[model samples]
Target: MTEQSAPGTDRLSSVATAARILREFGKHSTQLGVSQLARRVGVNKSTTHRIIWTLVDEGLLERVEETGLFRLTTTMRSLGASAETAQRLHEAATTPLDELRRYTAGTLHVAILDGTDVLYVERREGPGAIPVFRSVGSRNAAHATSTGKVLLAFLPAERQARLVEGMRLSPKTSRTITSRPEFLAELQRVRRQGYAENRGESEPGMCSVAAPIRDPLGQVVASVSVAEQVESVDAGLRHLVAPIVETAARISSGLGWNR
Candidate 1:
C-alpha cells in the first residue's frame, strides 16, 4: 500500500501553487486583473484576491491605480541586485579565469548554484573554442554539470537530500547519471576529490571540469570550470587544468566567500 502524505503537505503545496501564479505574473508583467489571474491560476476569485492582496502588501506585487490590475513590483529589484553582485564578483575573478584559459586554452565559465539549477554568471571563450552551449543568465540542471556537481557536493547533507528528493532525474544524454544512488555516490567522490568532472553528461561531445569556490567562511558560493571537446579533455589535460581552475576558485573565494 502507498504511504500517506505528511502533515502540512497540502499547505506547502498551496503556497507553492500560489507562488507559481505570482511567478507567471512576474514573467508577463502585463498588468493582470484579479479575475484574469484567478482564471489563469485555476483558483477561485476570493482566493486569488487574497493572495494578490498579501503579495501587494508585502511589496512583491503592485496594483495599478484606477485599473484594478496588478503587476510585479520593484521588490524584485533585490533579486536583480543579487544577480548584479554575482556578476561583479565574476568580473573580479576574470583575471585568474583568463589566466586559466590562457594556460589551458579551454573555455572558462563561472557559475553559482540557484535552487536545483546552476546559473552561469560569466564565460570566457578560449582559442579555437567550439561554440559555447551556455551563456551568462543561462541555467542548467545542477546534477548534470561539473560546476553544479561541485557546488552541490559542498551543500549540507540534509539540504542536498532535500534538493534531490522526489525530483525527476531526467537524463540529458546517454552518459548522464540520473540515478539517485549513483548521483549521491558521485557527490561523495567530489567531496573527497575536491572537484568534479562531467564527460558529456549535459551536452554530447563536450567535457567539463570544475572546482568549488569557497567564501571566507568556507561555504561553497560558486564554481569555476573549463569546458572543452571531449577528445581534448583527457587525463593528462585534466591534470594541467585542475590547478588553474582551483586558483581561479581561490581568487573568487577571497572576494568574500565565508567557509
Candidate 2:
C-alpha cells in the first residue's frame, strides 16, 4: 500500500520546502548550488532542485547558466525598494505630522493608497486628540475618508473608473457619497482644490482634511491628514487647509518631489 498525505499536505509541504529554500538563499551572499542548498536546509537534492526551479520560475530566484548556481533575483531588489520607500515615507512624515497634530490639537496621519483603501503608515496624536478610532497599519475604505479621497482624486480618470466599476457603494454615514456620479464630481473638486475634506462622512462626529504627498515624478504616492471632531473642525476648515497642504508639500519635498 502506498502512503498518502492528508488533504493539502503535499501543498503545505511544498510551501515549507520552498520557504526553506528561499531562507537558505538569504543566508548566502552569493549564488548557491543545489547540493549545497539541500545540505543547508536538510532537504533531499531532488526536492531542493524542484523548489529552486519553482522559485526561479516565479522570479524570486535566478539561475546562472555558466555555473548552474542560483541566486536571488531583481524581484527581491524591487521588494526592497518598495519597503525602503514606505520606510522613508514614514520617517520623513513623522516630524511634520507631529507638528501638525500639535498645531491642530488633533490626530495626524500619513497614509498610502492601497487599491481601494488607505493604509495608515504613521500616526501622531496630541493632547487634544479626539476620540476617533484608527491606528498605524489600519485600513479604511477609500471612498469614506479624506486621505482616500485625495488619493483617488489624484489617480488617472480611467484608473479611477476601473476601481469603481461594478463596485457597490457602501455607506458609512448619511453624509457619505454613495452614487458614482456624485463621488466622481467630489473627486473632481478635490483634484482642483489639491486637497480633500471629510465632514461627518466617515464617522458621525469626525472630520478630516487631507492633502496628497507627491513623488519626484509628480505622482501622488501618499497623503497627510488631520483628523478631529466635527465641532472642532466646522469653524476652521478654511484655515486648516493651508497648513495641511503645506505640511504635505514639505513631506513631498523631502521625498524628492521637486514640482
Candidate 3:
C-alpha cells in the first residue's frame, strides 16, 4: 500500500507542477525558457525540465529549434476547436443575426464576454453597409460599447466591479463615457431596460444598439448589436432597429439560452 501510494502522490505533484509551468509558459510564450519557467513556477531546474519534456512529448508544448525556447504547441488548436464546439453561441445566433442585418441594413455583431473584454464571435454586414472597424475574433473593452454594456449589466455587481477594477476606461472618442460612476449608472439602466445603446462611444460617428441574449435559464450568455454611422441613426432609425435587435436576442435565447 505504501509503495503504491508513493507513486500516486509523486504523479499528482508532477501534474501540479506541470500545470504551473504551463500557466507560466502561456503568460510569456514568446520568451519562455526552462530556467525562467522553473523560477517563475517555484520549481527546481531538473523537475521543470522533466515536466516540460513530458508536455513536449504529449504535444502540448513545443521547443523552437533555433532559440531552444519553449512555447505552446499546435495541439492548442484542438483545445480551441473543442471550446468552439462547446460554446455554439455563434451557431445559435446565425439566423437571428441574418434577420437583424436584413431589418437594419447595417452591421450586426454577436459577441460573448471574455474576461473583461467582449470577443466578437459572428458578424453579418448589410448590403451597401459602410465598412465596420470590428471583425470576428476581435476583442473590445466591455465597459465602453453597447454589446459589452448589456452583458456586463447582467453580471453580479461584485463580479462586474472586480472585472473593471484597474482597467483603463480609455476614451476611444469624445463621446465615450470613461468615468466609472457614470458607466455604472448606465449599466444599471441597461439591467432595468434589458438592453443598451452606444452613440459613437467606441469609434467616432459609429453608433450601436445592443440587447442581451440569454440562455433558457435567464443567464446572459451573449449579446447582439447593430452598428451604423451616427449620421444615419435618427430617432426613426432607433424605432425601426430596436425591435429587430430584441428579436435577434429572442432567437438566440431559443437556441438554449435561458434569461
Compute each candidate's TM-score over C-alphas: 0.66, 0.75, 0.65
Better of 2 and 3 by lDDT: 2
**lDDT of each structure?**
0.77, 0.84, 0.75
lDDT of 1 by residue, 22-54 (tens): 777656455888888888788889988888888
Which one is best on lDDT? Answer: 2
How do the residues 1-259 of candidate 3 rate in per-residue lDDT, one tens digit apiece? Answer: 4445654555678888988887675563554888998889898999999999999999988888999988878666456653663368766776666665446777777788878788887778765453544578888888778889998899988998887675688997777788988988998998997778887778767777888777767677788887777564233236544665566556666667544
Clashes of each: 11, 0, 7
lDDT of 3 at 134: 55
Tens digits of per-residue lDDT, candidate 2, 62-161, equal: 9889988988898775666567778999877877776775468878888887778888888887566645545788898889899999999998989988
What is the clash tally of candidate 1? 11
lDDT of 1 at 24: 74
Instruction: TM-score for candidate 3, please give it.
Output: 0.65
Q: Give me the displacement of residue 56 in model 2, in angstroms.
A: 7.5
Q: Residue 65 lDDT in model 3?
A: 92
Ranking by TM-score: 2, 1, 3
Kindly indicate the candidate among 1 and 3 with the higher lDDT: 1
